[model samples]
Target chain A: MSSTLLRTTPALRGALRASGALKATGALSSASFVRGKATLPDLPYDYGALEPYISGKIMELHHKKHHQTYVNGLNSALETIAEAEGKGDLSKAASVAPLLNFHGGGHINHSLFWENLAPASREGGGEPDGALKKAIDSDFGSFDTFRKQMNTALAGIQGSGWAWLVKDKSAGTLNLVTRANQDPVTGPYVPLVGIDAWEHAYYLQYENRKAEYFEAIWNVINWKTVAARFEKS
Target chain B: MVSLNTVWQYLALQSPLQLHSTMMSGDSFNLIKMGVTTFALPALPYAYDALEPHISAQIMELHHGKHHQTYVTNLNKALESHIAAVAAGDVAAQIALQQVIKFNGGGHINHSLFWQNLAPAGSDETKLEQAKELVAAIERTWGGFDTFKNAFSTALLEIQGSGWGWLTREAGSGGGLRIVTTKDQDPVVGGDVVIFGVDMWEHAYYLQYMNGKAAYVENIWNVINWKTAEDRFLGRSEEKNEL
Candidate 1:
């Protein structure tokens, strides 16, 4: 392996584990062994579970096709990098870093996304209780206001992207941020809740009415999962 | 296209008729050069569907007619306001226009280079001439032509979102060729001269390629105009020597 890949792979795996998204999915094997290959994590619930809010078709395609492609792409990129490294070509390995960021980000984001949602039943779409609720109130004035801000941000995405409710771990405060395309929420914030605004996410059901999709998603948001992410972060 | 000297002359006269005549004669470059700049969308060098199979007609049409046109329009609008802000000495307004200028200006610049960099498959330009010094530079930097192509394609596919992958002549770094990626419509702003660029934006290929960006990147190699790249690389090199 290239010296860079050898040094960076373990650190990247550490960051992915520390991200809490992989842990939330319960699919990541022990960090010691899981270095380069990234597999698609199975959805926490059945495909049809998040019905009415997110249709079975969207869930099935998003997971099996979209997320799976990223997993495949990530593994392929890793293999290419390893091959380049074997030849002692560090620049060739460096060139594929963006592939790593995109595919690895897709895996991490979708893994969190599947867990971040649930059917309206089973504690899916209601107001948060306890500490999570207090944090939301403290961060954005009130839950209603936070919802409004997040919806506006999600709707305003010009192209394929995601809107996130992330926690600034150091400050212990929640912040709303948006990422273009499959970019994962990195840096000081730990992603608490992420809403995929990619057209493929809601286009079949909602069509051009992205605002409606954004509004409906609130009904199926797994706040319990979000709270767990926040607590862990 | 109007020469920079024509723009200087037109600015002195500031005649509406002079401007209209220049524009009617297909000299929009003067307008771009003048502070009253209005950038028109450049006509595609080839047909909308010229590079078929490699790039679908629909993708090319939408990408050029719609996407590129939007950038041209927005860039003109932004520049119009920006000129006024500068005239008024409004520092805040100038600062606020920075993002708009970078996004749209970058889009316009990048897309313009992108269109010229592509040719219909089977173009005579595919085979690099040994006489072309740029070919030697590319070989020296990346070991061989195939290796350079692989590195460029790999870098292009890896872009996380809407961005561009570029083959730039790094004048500051002794005129070597470098592969770089820029997020969004951020033009190659560093001291490098962009020789060729590929749009990694989904709009560039999503209609046909769907999520198969790697396929799109790989296939683009069949249509690249190496002659244009060689010209750009050599042009930058000559300019550096003149300095």
Candidate 2:
């Protein structure tokens, strides 16, 4: 299965393209297609860019090893589905749907994750200004309150998962949500920011101290990119 | 006297043993007639250490005492909130609670079934008459015990993330057996009655098996309580036949 076929449905691609987040982040451009195979999107910055807050070791392993596995799995699952469909074996496709979700979600979430961060030297840390700031204040009371809520929600996840700040397009409001083990933000919500709470994301640096990791993550958040995502949504 | 409708409802809702007991014990009839029941963590049929060498005592302790207990607790909590939401007609709240209910409820159901379907190796229960019937069925459906084991293990290993692999009797397929897998803690429900299931969740095997899930899959066969699986298969088949 090619990356193009596996990464997103045609509908999802249209949504992403419309949102302009995919274009803005240059994720679509960086995506190298070898015979339409799904390839890992290159990190926008150096692996060590978010160092001190997130060790370069973690970023390297996460991006190279962890993210790559999902790419492989997603492509494999897509191939399986295609072959099953070719044989008119829908049961085989149904059985492998979980893999598609898990791996495809992994690829999507991590792709967003890499773009969601920037170096502290690059105005990564600090508060959002303009419409994004006003939306935050209006929806979640204030920036501090939003931060606290996100931290609490992220810390409360029982297992490997992610915490998201998503735009509910229908209601036109920002909401905080959590998903377990590579489940993407589905439905009407367009994800603006996501924090990986999986053990691999922080175990080496924080060692079960999820609160500390969550706290440190804020320092490296690329607020400008998040603002762009919010605006696009 | 309970209304005839209430009796019919009770018969529809209650488990076989509960129904049988309700019929036998007049004092308990009124309580069950009102439709109040809660799930609890069942006692392990054998000592925690009984399946050691194949599965560690520590793994059993945490898997049952900690993991399974947490699921039971959370499921109860979710159900409590769900009941209130349904009573209040809070459809949004009910919708939000669906994942909570499925995760905890499936965890509870799967773990409960998993415990019953395992025993210490070489036990008398391993090869009883009931187990013989199950083996015969396995051979018939899958073309022999070894083939069935291989196919089941392959399915179990292929579960990409946390999930369960089951040998279930397809309800409308004339008692046909199929090996199926489900993601996360989703329970094997619908018309399929699970005869035997293996937990592929990391927590189920991570402590003892680590990343070597193949080893865990291989070793679990040693502890499978074939008699219990046979009983469940026979019981479900009998119920279907009666219907």
Candidate 3:
């Protein structure tokens, strides 16, 4: 609605489509952080802290071991790939491609996943205080409509990846998007919420049944933290 | 009368503590020999029979006793195996097991809370003040309650096979109520963090709604404790006061 909408960098725009003024993660979304270049941050809460929604066992495994593995593998791949490139062994680096994709993806995805995790009981998915709600209402005709749009977008994702609620900084509204594989949501938007679709992220207990898993997780989304993010960033 | 009393006393004597302890001592001996500790199912807050036709006693039995038990059993098994993996010097196996441990473990953990989230068969709430706040918020954002319901129902209606629909608040972008979905095994709390949500997985509704997801979602409207949800939504605001 304002003259500054689309020009606010991809970080401050509208839905990248059903989902708000989508904004992106600045250069973080576009740039590749090599193995040596990055680190997995320690969590504010203990591995067991998110219990009930995500068990202590799951958190321990997901963080200490699984995500750490990605970090370790990422470190290995980047150093090796860089060496290969130095020797002009293009083919060697080419062979190293999957390593980078897999490990790098693991690191990136897990890092993103951590920021999203928090105790919902305390946080309450932060309410949209003002403008975000207003825009959502105007664009989708109501907040409920926006939610429905996001749900449809998430349920539609096939295989592993993510569903995003982004502020399309350009359009200045929230939008829903499904990313294929570990493809980052790199458009002109900022991430507000991301739902992981990796089979490993769920499976096991849910078995081949994904719908049940989807249905159970609604109990824990933290709205309070989200609202704060909207206020500051 | 005296003879009958004597007879009852004699019958009680047959089942005395002395006899019971002597017999049960064998179980202690066996436990000492095997060194296994017992773990029992945690009791539910309400009786299984409490929530009647809305949620059948049979389903609660299976869900709590059978399904939940299986998770606990498997989790313990997985933990034991993980300890073995560490002892046997199989780092790779240990790492591999991590995924299953967490996934199954999380499944067990999440569902336990979920069972409590639902009302046991009987009745529901008016949610008075909370409903008024929520209704006002909805009206401000979407015009009225019907619009919000239609929109929310639309979300519940469109699950891709299995997942959850959340009314989450995201930070930095005004705390607008956002609806989002997550795939199988993926929890909003872990990856996206949900404040509260509706389970759209067929298990949540199959027994009740069958393939009619739309109908199941619509019916849920009657059950939602707006008061509970409102408290959660307002939870963060309370924290700000401390600062």
Candidate 4:
């Protein structure tokens, strides 16, 4: 992750280091430039570690196949955009927006998602503590309440998308929001925790019973990572 | 004997000639001359609530009016931009627009066929007996209707992401019934006759069925319009008899 952080600014690198997110090495490259290639990151834990809650099969496919596609797509879109812009083909460059948004968002979202998970035997599941816990309680009533609300948001998503627990920078408040497809959490809201609602995330294990997947995933959620992100935000 | 596949192959070759004429024509910016057709949402043949219990009215309204309509709307918008790009000879822009066109266009095509593929839950069209030829083919291919149903259901469940399951027939001689799947709004193309397609996207069943996908797949048979499938299946035979 530190090596990949080479693409980002020093301030972002500092923030990431402070948040303890740097330990999930190789999970993200932030943004890869035209010449930079976004590669698949190494998971902090083994695939089978998140078992019972999220099957190893699902994890392997999600991380390898799905995430790899997004990485390849994002790198390709960035290359195309750079080439088009170099040719002074502004229209052609602009036309690549959808691909950039889809693939780029996918890459960012999955990178965050992997860090937010851990094996149940480790720092996974359980409630958050310290400043992060206080924020969750204050903004969303109680931890239990916030969990239920997040689950509800996950269920409400139509087609394929994600439900994120985000923080409003100005207000210092936590909010739950949903994004259609791979539309990443951006703007003023800093995404602290994201749960994938796309069918591929859970279809193999939970089938169409997505609510179970949503509910069960919490068992493997690395609160430490989320807390770090929340505190940093 | 001229096989249904050969007849379809002959017809398929004619499209490129028409497309070539449209491209070669000097009418710049003429959408009509380019043969770019604007797609519209087709009205459902039955009432929204007609497939109640199996598929709720709310789901139908949203699936047809909202979901399907969005596809039609976006596809038209993409086509408009695509035509402009073509006129400007912006090949890169045109290439970029291809994906959007494919996604939205496939959505429109799939949903249009999906609506017609279903009848009222207990209606006469739902009966397998009504589609004798298709039923016979199913029996011939899979040995029984139940076996075919199970296979179709399994395929629908196996789709990893958003997609559709279809029963299609190959064109020409030696081609027979086959089951296939397409991911993320990809419509069935080529020489195959699409007997029917079942929408596997979560929006198709999530609201009404709510994660009970197997149940949704099971109940879908109750509303399947086998009559339409029979007609599509026997179309070539009917033409052959005329000849």
| Best-performing candidate as measured by TM-score | 1
Candidates arranged by lDDT, highest first: 4, 2, 1, 3
Docking class of 4: incorrect
**Ordered list by TM-score, greatest first:** 1, 2, 4, 3
Model 2 stretches astray by more than 4 angstroms: A1-34, A39-66, A77-102, A114-131, A144-161, A168-173, A177-190, A197-233, B1-38, B46-58, B81-102, B121-130, B170-173, B190-192, B208-212, B236-243
CA displacement after TM-score superposition, residue A196 of candidate 4 (Å) = 3.1
Which candidate model has the greater DockQ, 3 or 4? 4
Indicate which candidate wins on lDDT: 4
Model 1 residue runs over 4 Å out of place are: A1-39, A44-61, A69-105, A118-148, A151-161, A168-173, A179-190, A197-233, B1-37, B80-93, B123-137, B140-143, B172-174, B236-243
Between candidates 1 and 2, name the one with more favorable lDDT.
2
- Alpha-carbon RMSD to native, per candidate: 8.9, 8.4, 24.9, 15.2
lDDT tens digits, residues B162-234, model 1?
6889998886648778999998887775457778888887677756766667898889888888787787787
How large is the interface RMSD of each prediction?
3.8, 4.5, 11.9, 8.1
Off by over 4 Å in 4: A1-233, B1-31, B34-37, B236-243
For residues B167-199, what per-residue lDDT tens digits would candidate 2 score against the true structure?
998888598889999877777766578898998
Error of 2 at B98 (Å): 6.0
Model 3 alpha-carbon miss at residue B162, Å: 16
lDDT of 1 by residue, A23-134 (tens): 3221233222323456677778888888888889878878998899988877677667766665778899888888877787787788788888988878689888789999
TM-score values for chain B across all models:
0.81, 0.81, 0.62, 0.85
